[model samples]
Target chain A: MTTHPHMALVLSRICARFADEERHDLSVLRDVTFSVRTGSFVSIIGPSGAGKSTLMRVILGMMLPTSGEVVRNFSRPAMVFQNYALFPWLSALDNVAFGLRMSSVPKQERERVAREKLKEVGLLHLENHYPAQLSGGQRQRVGLARALAIQPDFLIMDEPFSNLDTITAEELKADLLKIWRAYGITILMVNHLIPDAIELSDQIILMGAHPGHVEKVVAIDLPRPRDTRGALFFQDVDALTEEIRKIS
Target chain B: MIRSVTHPQAGPWHRIHLMRHRRALILMTIVIGIAVLFGISGYFSGVAWPTLLEAVLRTTYRLALAYGIALVLGVTIALLVGWSPFIDFFFPFFDILQNIPSFALFPLFIYFFGFTDQMIILFATSSIVWPILFAVLTAIKGAHKDLNDAATIFGATGFRRVSFYLAPLALPAVLTGSIVGIAIGWEAIIGAEIIANIAGFGAFIKNVDISGIDASAVAGALAILVIVFVINRLVWAPLLLESSRRYAE
Candidate 1:
């Protein structure tokens, strides 16, 4: 892999809080800090309500941090939402081309590039099909294509495969790794499945609830296409599972 | 002994048989046939064809005017209420206003606007606004979170996001609302013209009533019905069906 000198994104002492008059304070994130190197694939794993999604919102600038800073090197950072978020009214091709249109790319070139990106994700045949017509896996693939077509330097994905069936999720995970390797874009993904994080990521940041914070950061030395049957893989998964258990 | 066995046949004929239910089709045909019969009877009964035709045209012009104004006002208000919390707090006022019968304001409108075109337009607008505004607000509130996130992440902000993402996503709901609004506008325009003595279909219908020509008023009403039906079939129905096909889950 080619090395780049600059880091892709840096989150320093980030904090998020939600307040409602009817309820007590909801502090989803506190003092969360991390840095993703250029072209690195980082995964965040936690049980439910660990602020994994909150962290992603902060990174995407959808939720502003109450304190600290999030510095991104990229002008545009694309995100794959957990729900796939494809526009119901638009076809898969139009969904992928949305960013291109926003940037005022020429109509013909945008269509051409969007077509190429959809083809890359094995969705060229479904270009004219709207999101409502697609299966769950197909919709997520379209979402991935949309993020990819933007040619973003950083890709933030929030629980992208959690809604899929196990087999389809695995297939999509493998596809994601292949795309990540081919394009060399920086990826930061959140996952509840420990094995998924181990298989797809270079590093895993485990989060704990009760005013959510990072509890552990483990560097996975295991190679790509990681074997779940392997001893080290099971060890890491078990350890992370135990850590999550303690928090809950 | 040889035994003959029969299996259920599965073929295009069988499928057609399964799809062709008699009772529902018969019922629908009967209702439509009755309506057409009444329409034809009304057409043949000494109705002044040219006069009613002119009145129908005038009514269409008034509908166009009222609908155009309501579209702009309703959509703008809905967007404001959807996006801003401050505006949303005032939504109750809108609800109360919508409940106030638009026809009840006819006297007030005539008093202020002096029984002119302006009174008719104002009445039509008042009747049309509520449905379109509510439809748009509901749509905006119910928008999918993922699409909104995608728009933001893609740098779709301000006017661009409103035009591309919000507008297209809310289009089906807006169309549905506009249809209701147009229907209301039609009723209001006719009623206002009758009460206010405007130069339109309702005034013509009142004149026919005064002349004891019941058939002409009926014919004029029938003409309006036919025009509405054609617009629904040719314009709104096809668009709605297409949108539902493309967007409905």
Candidate 2:
């Protein structure tokens, strides 16, 4: 046990279960334990059915684990879902300002902060547009803007770039790192690509299927602004890929 | 660097705006045409203008009261019976209740309410509420799960959740249902009046039929058509357009 409160969030042997139509209990996650260090980028990497999304929900406190505990040291944790989840009825500005309104922030301040966040994500011009009017990339940016506008101590992203094209995803990944470094906020991202986890995270939590559990946690000691196409990056990517393949 | 600025003139909003203006113009023309027709029919049918006006006002009152009550109760019931296992049990009962023809229960209402306006209003409300309730129910049930998750994550709870998320999601459904409800309300109220011989448009039409069809009856028919057109144009049409513009699939 550490004396300092260094972890932003902690999951102690979390397990989630669901009952089917037949009332038979099905395990979705099992004995998943992890600690997210404050102000660091961590990625949860695994294949399909690895309970990655379920893990995110548990950490976000949206869903309760069956047998384990989740401790969030910070309040106001925000999430960007794989589908972006922008409200179709709301304008981009309104969507971004939603969390502030929920917090009962003054309207003017909410608009100002929402606009700033949108500008940060380079979506300032689309403030009046609805999600239906936006491209997939633009929609994800709006989701990012919305999450960031809350000024949360913790930001959880569930496959944020999964719906975008390759170029948009690459650009988004770069923008995300830039924001992470600029804000110095703790981020826990769930991603399917092992190379992406190695590229963006300070630590990668590899998860395995069969009632999904944490398999391994690998640290990336690479320097900031690391080149994705560089030799060191490739080696780390290859090693992590092989390890993930073995476990998953 | 100079660039060609091409702002598309055919965006959804633009198209809706144009459509609304055109619809309004057409509605106004129809209203004017109906007024002209009413005048012609009144002159030839020998129906006094004052009597016709009284009949119109009375029917309008009943329709407004019934439709208003249905609007409030339908949405209220829908919100109360929102997506849950309750729907599985509650909806089937609601379906059966709606199918038990309004006319079939007219005698029961007349016995209890004594052929008063209250009886007519209640009967009309029963007929009007089902469409709105079911439409809202379907919308609520079919709302995207991702949107629900996002709302929860953002700390939207209780009233705020309903206002911010559920209401807007269900708006199109509400408008569509309201249109159908109004139409059914018109039918039910008119039928109730004819059966009960209440002092309204239906009674006037029944009295005209007994006395013999004249130009006055034709004028009254024209007046009914005008009322339907005006309500659609002034109320339901705009609401439908607005809802579709914002929330349609």
Candidate 3:
């Protein structure tokens, strides 16, 4: 790894709260503080309604925290939304080029970079197809290509593979790891799938919620291409599963 | 060497299939057949075709003018009402206005505009504006949240947002509303011309009634039918098809 001393992102005492229909206070996230190192792969995992999504939204600037600060070193970070928010009217190529064009990248360069990024995601052939014309897996690939084309120093994803079928999701996760290794991008991803989080992340932050809080942070010491059926893999899964159950 | 020229395969056969579903064509043919049958029977019965033709021409001109005025007023009002959130608070008031029979205002219009072409145009425009405005507002409000969010995220704010995202999404609804408005306009113009004795198809029918000339009245009605058919085929039908194709998911 290329040595970078500074942290890529920092969250200082972040808190997010919402009001219920009865007008009572509801805290989604409380006093959460963490920092992602440069070129680190971090996964946030929790059960349903555990503020995993809220954390992602707060980081993306989509939702403002009730209190605390989020600081970043990057100029513009790219996000892969949970729903794969590809513009319906735009074709795959145009969707991938959207942010570049917004930043006033010349048209030819934008297209060239978009094509190259899409080719990385194995979606170059679908350049002319609209979101509606593509399957769910294809649309997600385009979404990844869009985030990748920006060539951001940091990549943020929210349940990026939650919608895909099993086989496609596995293939995509492997592809993502390969790309992550090649680019050395700092990634913070949210996932509900334990195996996926374990397979891809260098560290997993396990969260729980009555009012959401981080329960544990586990570091994966295993090397790349960790086997799901291996003894160590099952042991880790079993321990994580028990911890998640206790929190619920 | 003698070569027989073969025409290149004319577009797709699906287009021919779509043409067969043209309701305007079918409606026109039915109307024309009825008109020709009536004319032939009237001619044999010694009804003067020249007088009938004159009355039909007068009626056609009146309907055309009234429809033109209605079109302008309806489209303008629809755009305004659809875009303004503050103005939308008065929609129920407009709804009440729509329920008021436009013919009920004929006496007031004649008293003010004095049975002139302007009076007829006023009546037609009043009849046309409400439905179009309501339809456009509904369409704008009903636009998908995802598309709106995407537009906002992409920095499609201000006038560009309205022109690009709002306008295209609202187009299909606008077309539907306009078609309904135009149909109402046709009914209003004819009724206003008849009641107010304006120089229009309705007035021609009134004159035919007073003179006891059944053939001329029939001919005037036929002319109105043909004109409406032509307008629907030439303008509204194509617009509806185009809007549906462009905006449909």
Best by TM-score: 2
Residue-level lDDT of model 2, residues B142-213, one tens digit each, is 777778889989978777877777777778888889889988888898888899999888888888889986
B-chain TM-scores per prediction: 0.79, 0.86, 0.79
Comparing 2 with 3 on DockQ, the higher-scoring candidate is 2
lDDT of 1 by residue, A1-248 (tens): 23335778787888888885878788888898877888989999777777777788888778888888888776668999889988888899999999999999999999999999999889999999898778899999999999998998889898899899988898898899899999999999987788888888888888877677888788888876688799988998898778778767
Worst 10 residues of 2 chain B by lDDT: B240-249
Cα deviation of B136, candidate 2, in Å = 2.3
**In model 3, which runs have C-alpha deviations exceeding 4 angstroms?**
A1-5, A17-28, A51-55, A104-106, A209-213, B1-32, B43-140, B184-249
Against the reference, the lDDT scores of all candidates come to 0.83, 0.85, 0.75
- List the lowest-lDDT window of 10 residues for candidate 3 chain A: A1-10
Point to the candidate with the largest lDDT: 2
TM-score of each: 0.87, 0.88, 0.72
lDDT of 3 by residue, A1-248 (tens): 23325888777788999998999989989888777888889999877767876787677677899999887766557777667777665679988887777667899999999999889989899898777667788888898888888787888888889989998898888888998999989999989888788888888888887667888888988776788889998888888788788878
Better model by lDDT, 2 or 3?
2
lDDT of 3 by residue, B101-157 (tens): 888877888888887877777777777777766777677666665445545554445
